[model samples]
Target: MELSEYCALDATALRELIRTGQVNAAEVETAARQAIESVNGDLNALTQPLFQSALDHDPDGPIGGVPFLVKDSGPFARGVTFTLGSRSIRGAVAAVDHELMTRFRAAGLATLGQTTAPELGLSYATESLRYGRTRNPWALERGVGGSSGGAAALVAAGAVPLAHGNDGGGSVRIPASACGLVGLKVSRGRTPSGPLAGEAGFGLIAEFGLTRSIRDTALLLECVSGPAVGEKYTLSSPDVRYTEVLRADPGRLRVAVTTDAWSGVPVDLQVAGVAAEAARTLEWIGHSVSPATPGIQPDDIVEGSMLAAVATGAALLRAPVRPDPGRLEAVSRALLAETLAFTALDVMAALDAQNRLTRAVGTFFTEYDLLVTPTLAQLPARHGELDYDDPGYSMRDWLRRIYQYGPFTAAFNVSGNPAISLPLGQSREGLPIGVQLVAATGREDLLLQVAAQLEQAQPWAGRQPSVFAG
Candidate 1:
């Protein structure tokens, strides 16, 4: 197959071609490599290339021969360098495949590369000193939101159909929104987190990926869902496969729309406007839409996140290498220093607050089937917008800035509800603007149904980034 033809197909389509012998696995891998070679230099998306490893993929497996990229931070594969986009742990290599990685392999995905992430996955923008900036395929000067920035950039630029991404605080969704892809953050226990740590970010982190198609998202979730052995938490299986659920009717959903920035900072008018239009579209499609939101205080979110992050930082410092302050980014070092000062009581307080907030947000869902909001508060920021290396940067100020950029996303991570970012609109400057759809915990089926409906109503596949592989 031609490289352009290969770049145009999603994982499922590519897998079908291989299954039917229309194209061989090696041909698909070569096409993917050509696509990456065509655009990765300017985009800096793939941080580590595993082309030889990918060549050995099973042609008989479900998505066998589909070229895939795993994020560098987590969801590790054995023998691959798992740098969290930081100089502190530059040479760390994974000794064993994490359960998710094992499952990805079992599902027939050809893991060919690792994508860049922010330092310690701390920032929303992917501008790490270790790997430099990961530029957005849509607009190179703008940031591709992180820490899944590189993954999103690669997928959007057509280097791959889908790529692995984990969301702690909007890592997956933020970049998906920025790069115009489908990003879903499943419920806390919907996917596994074993053999490394019990739960990431005190259960605030959820593992998933960014994809160009809703079916690809559903296919991947089906492939990777369920608990690994000795898991601390496990969720009840969906009534039907996510792919099957897509064909079923969602019925009339009671969706509440909110443009209220949780931080009290004003949302950009264009961003809010697009989200409002999404709500209108939902209403037009027979779902009830209203302007209502959970009363979540910005300070509460900041405090809870800080506590979880500090605890995570403390745990990282206990690792064998023991991070050096000079090697760490300024923001990371400051966060570590602050975490070191946190007392046990302080940690407990944060956990308690997170629990309360989760229950509080859960209450809103009792009245509404889903909540709609702008995935981000503003358009994609410039590459250096969130300067972690600024001499005057303070943790408090930095947190405030983060809340401003991502006011709508972190709450769902804290609540452990299923949230997805869909590229439904565009900014005047031609950047993709994503709208978020959030369902109650364990309701990813409903989320996907609604998202697929939107995808069909206004297809986003034809829209290509300026720096595209084709």
Candidate 2:
């Protein structure tokens, strides 16, 4: 098969082809390699390409011999290069396969490569010191949001149909929103993470993937979710598959819409317009939508959660072969330095704020089944907008800018609730604008139900970027 044809098929279609012996896993692997070689130069989204392992794997398998790519920010495929976009650990290879990745392979996904990420998955935009910048597929000058930014860019560019992503603080959703893909941050503990690691950033987050199709995302989650042996916590699974839930009627949902950030920060006009359109789309589908704010003290909580996140960042700096504290970008180094100011009590305080904010949002969900908001307060910022170039601002100011821009997503993570970013609208600049649909903790089924309805209302599945149009 031609690389173009192989790159075009979604995971299910590829698997069907494999099962029918129309194509072999090796051919798919070659196609993925060729695609990466052809486009990665312009994008800089790939960190490691594992073509040989894919050739050695099964062809007529579940992922149907489809080639898959993973984010380089996290520890996943064993013995693979994992540089979380830092110059410090330029060629660090993981000692073993992370548990979630094992599940990916078991489900018949052939691992052909790894994608780029922001440094330590810390930034929202994916301009890393190690690999330079991962450019957006739609518009090269704009950034793909980080952590999962490269994965999102690759999927958006048609380099791959689905790629792994993990959300600690909107990492998955941020890129998905920016790139116009279906990015689901599954409820915490919904998927097993083990062997190589257990629980990320103090159980504040977990990892998953980004896909062009809701069905592909739903099926990927179905394959990945469920408690692993010896897991500290697990969520209750629905009796039916999430894909089925997508087709199922969501019933009448009371969805609360807020154009403003939870902290009362005004949203960019285009961002708000996209979110309002999504609300209108919900109304078109018989759902009740209204302007209502979820109660959150954005400042108080942002400080605390940020401490936790920066503390995680600090730990990475203190990891063996620490980046030349000087070599580290000014912004990231400042963040790590600020984390040093936190005491154990400070971490506890952050945890307390997280719990309180989670509870406050939970109360809103008690009255409203869903909360809808712009995935970000603004469209994807130009490259270097969030970079550490301005060393004058303290770390807190830098973090506040990020918080104000991304207030909606972190709350769901703190609450351990499920949220999905649907690419239902676009900015005037032709950039994709995503609307977030959040459900109560463990209510992913219902969230998918609403998303599926939205998908049908304004079908965006075929809206590929120019690169992917081939």
Candidate 3:
């Protein structure tokens, strides 16, 4: 198979091709390798490419034999080595597959490589001292959104059909927006975090992957959604399969759309306009749409996220083999310092805020079936625009900076809502603007149905990044 042909197909199509013997798995793997080789140096998306391991992997399952990349960020896979995109940590190998990896394997995704994430998965920009900057495939000078940045870059560039990503505070969605891919952050507990921990980022993070199409997102959720054994959360499965929901009509219902950032920061006008247009698309599709905010407070996003982030950093820095703060980037070191002064009462406050924030969002659903907003406040930033290494910012200041750029996505992380960011609009300059659709907890079926409609209304499949394999 040609690299261009391989790059053109989504994971579902590739799976069908491999299964039907139209193209052998080995050939697809080779095309993927060549695609990676051609663009990875320019993009710096791969921290480690396991081409030989991929060759040896005899995948079998629903998506068997399709190329996939795991984020360096977490939910470990056995035998895979990771540095978590930090310079201070020595490389370590996982002893067992995290439950998510187990599901990925069971679904037949051939894990070919690891993508770069921000240090401790904190920043939105994938640029790090170790991995360097992971340039956007769409615009070489710009960033591909953080932590999941490299994954977005590779997948958008067509190096792989899909790649794992986790969102504690927009790590997946922001990058998906910046890179023009389908980023779905499943409801908390919809996917497992582990044999390692019950929850990642204190239940603020949801593990999933970035994809090219809504159907891919639907099928993937069907394959990976469900609780792992011994999980703290055991959400009941959806009444129907997610893929089936794509064809089902999402009944005309109340829809709420907001251009305002929860943080009360200014959203770029272009982005807000795109979000407004997306709401109009929803209205055109027969849903009742209105301008509305979820009534969630800024503290709901900032405090809830701050506590989760500080705690995560504290655990890593306090481990037996402690990570040296001197080796960390300016922002991560600031986070570590904040962890020291952190107190139990602070934890209580954060938890309280989480309760209030989640309650506020939950209450909004009483009036609306879904909410639409710009996935980011602005477009994909230029390199170094989100300076992770700048010592001028404190932990709170850093959070504020990130929240300014992407104020919409973090709230759902705190609220445990299922949110999907779609590349529904593009800039005149050609950058992708992500329009996010959020549904109440365990309502992914609703999200997918509407997403399917939006995908049809504003199709993005023909759009390709400048740095594509094709």
Measured against the true structure, the TM-scores of the candidates, in listed sequence, are 0.97, 0.94, 0.98
Which portions of model 3 miss their true places by more than 4 Å? 55-58
Candidate 1 yields a Cα-based lDDT of 0.86
Residue 118 of model 2: what lDDT? Answer: 79
How do the residues 131-230 of candidate 1 rate in per-residue lDDT, one tens digit apiece? 8999999999999998899999999999999999999888999999999999999998999887787877888888888999999999999988987778
lDDT of each: 0.86, 0.78, 0.88
Q: Could you arrange the candidates by lDDT from highest to lowest?
A: 3, 1, 2
Q: Rank by TM-score, descending?
A: 3, 1, 2
Model 3 lDDT per residue over 320-354, tens place: 68887888999888888889888999988889999
Candidate 2: residue 192 Cα off by (Å): 2.6
List of clashing residue pairs for candidate 3: 124-146
Q: In lDDT terms, which candidate is top? A: 3
For candidate 2, lDDT tens digit of each residue in 66-185? 777888865667777776777766667777777788788778777778788877777788887778888888888988886799899888887777989988878899899999999999
RMSD of 3: 1.3
